[model samples]
Target: MTETATAPAGGLPEAVFDPERLAAVAASGLLDTPAEGTFDDLAELALAITGAQKAFFTVADGRRSFWKAAIGLDAGAVRENDIRDSPCHILIGTGLPLIAEDAVNDPRIRDLAAVGALGIGAWAGYPVVSPEGHVLGGFCVVDQDARPFTPGQTRALQTLARSVSSEIALRQALRQARAAGDASAALARTLQDSLLPPRLAEAPGMDAAAAHLAADATGEAGSNVVGDFYDLFHTRGKNWAAVMGDVCGKGVDAAKVTALARYTVRAEAGQHTHPSVVLHRLHQALAAQRVSDRYLTAALASFRPAADGVGVVGRYASAGHPPALIRRADGSVEELDAPGTLLHPDLPPAQDALKDTTFRLFPGDALLLYTDGITEARDRERGPLFGDARLARTLAATRGWDAARTVDHLRRAVREHSGGHAVDDTALMLLRVAGGPA
Candidate 1:
């Protein structure tokens, strides 16, 4: 199909040509880029489910629609064309999906020259948005015959579109963060915060809370950006996940691995019910790309509210990380005994060492996941490290406490133990089952 006029069409919104939105499109790095497997997979899935004749994952600049991935289109077909010639521009203008079940007679674009040239009987496009909420382009499907899409198909297409948005946003965020390496503590804090969940996902029948105490809590200049990250999120169905990890080094290198570990676990946790499998998948991802020589230790748990409503039941795995702790409602603490090797691409045999065990959190009981920073804190005189024994004793003293209070209590204890000078960053997540005894 030949290119069309560059001006906005009659029904298209003028915002499609906004300068900032166009800038976001440029920053997306999707325009004119080589095809990517992720985008290709999205296009393939879109076509598979919709039974569409063709699919396109595209990015649009002011004048041209650049195809990032296309399926069912011949190699000689135009890969880039005037933005006005494609319905994706309508999605950009409206910031919404453009679905034309009968594109040949669809008033919005039937008059366009390319519609007849491409023989589009039906068309559906979902906006691929930027992190800042700008419409960068779209994931669209085209059919040779007019077809009505079911609600289920529409929802699936929307989900796939969101995955595309997430992939782009993550790449953009990490690029910006790595580019800011060793720049400023304020920037370091911002970059570190980006690696963590903005807030913990609400857990059914449980109280969830988390905190990160930076090694440089004093707000001093030139503090190393250590890799201590934690996340609490809901996986598929009734399943929920909690993870805590510490990368081997500091600064942008650590941040890169931290981002990778967090994203990989998130992408895999929904597919697997076992933490060990999720963690092993993470290992494979890390091994596939040696971003750095740095290795990391992680604790991952997948749990769900019990059918009896008495507590939570799930399995947790440890990879050369400290054990997770359970503080019973009666004020006694029990240590978990799952240990495995640290995560490094080169440590294939260590995968066998990874172990996961079933556990339950009864009402009034709390589950604690933490990095070693808390246990390794020393006093101002650099005396004995705070150690696991003290942590257990302290946790046992916080009986009947909610997750929030438990986490706060531990943070204060660590701060005082270290005389307000932590040698490393500390991260903690606690989930307390409801209806605990007073």
Candidate 2:
């Protein structure tokens, strides 16, 4: 077959390759593929347009030369050659395709006996470059008889090469995205596990339990672990203190804040006798950081044993979180009205206040402290929130059970109400007042 140079009317600069572009192309993992229809079509089109006997696509990955697709060449003919001896390798380094009308007269290939032995006298090549300017490979046509390429044919090959480059870029981007997603998921799992205590601390005169559920559909696993956290600890005076709170956002930053808030409450509660005073201390500690935009909504409560006639007393304070639900032994549920403002000092005055409230815990009574994630959980069918009223009703229904049983029922109810899909992180602390202090 005759090899002819078909160039568009005007002479155009040849395609150039660069080291940065080569690196990007090398990363795509597209080289050395078995013939696919897409590449095969391009090869066949190249031969038809250039009127050459053979056409091929070659990718060079530093150490190896890979022929992705080829026409009119034996399958076994596709093999890696020494880069030092390959004239095409030199042309690639120059960032331009080599157009040789006669290999015997071309200085770059004249001394290369392989071209003469293969009966290849004419050659034309176009560099395949990625959008970011990486040279992935080259598309070329060859013939036994020498001829010149027309301008139109050269342009057609260049267009086809660009299409190949785009595919390479798309594949590379997808790989990067998947890798990022995997890393994020691993990080989320680690953060969630680290923030939660390995086991809940048992307290006398109270059956204490905590539950935290993270939304499954939010950002990448490690990208955003909702920052809701809860903890139960004993004070130096033997009273039991519990705190539940949610940081303002999800992800790593929020997790950091959640951890800080949790420890701040525990430390302050141990030093103070009243829950309100403990909460105030936590606010001040957080305020000192000057992170006014990053706030936490929390409930801090202390359970103290009562004297002769009086039952146990639960003193609690709220900072922008949902009010605590108290289930009395009489099968009634009361929403304790606490006074508090959101934790951020810079928030408007209307939102910066804190509320402190008290509740008398009779024998077998239970108290539930939770973040807004529970009440705001959406119902699957109606798209409305599960809401505080439903939470109250649920607690009332489960009031007959002990602390552990009540928490179990409440968790199930919340999950069901949200269609088994938690859209935010939910943290709950349940404290049951036993018949007498243990």
What is the C-alpha local distance difference test score of candidate 2?
A: 0.67
Highest-scoring model, lDDT: 1
Residue-level lDDT of model 2, residues 364-433, one tens digit each, is 7888888887898886464888898899988888756777777778889989888887667787878887
| Tens digit of per-residue lDDT, candidate 1, span 279-378 | 8877876775566778999999999978887798989999989999999999999987587889987877555787789999898999999999999988
Worst ten in a row by lDDT for model 2 = 4-13
Error of 2 at 128 (Å): 60
C-alpha lDDT score of every prediction, in listed order: 0.80, 0.67
TM-score of 2: 0.54
> Candidate 1, clashing residue pairs?
364-436
For model 1, where is the 10-residue window of minimal lDDT? Answer: 1-10
Off by over 4 Å in 1: 1-184, 217-223
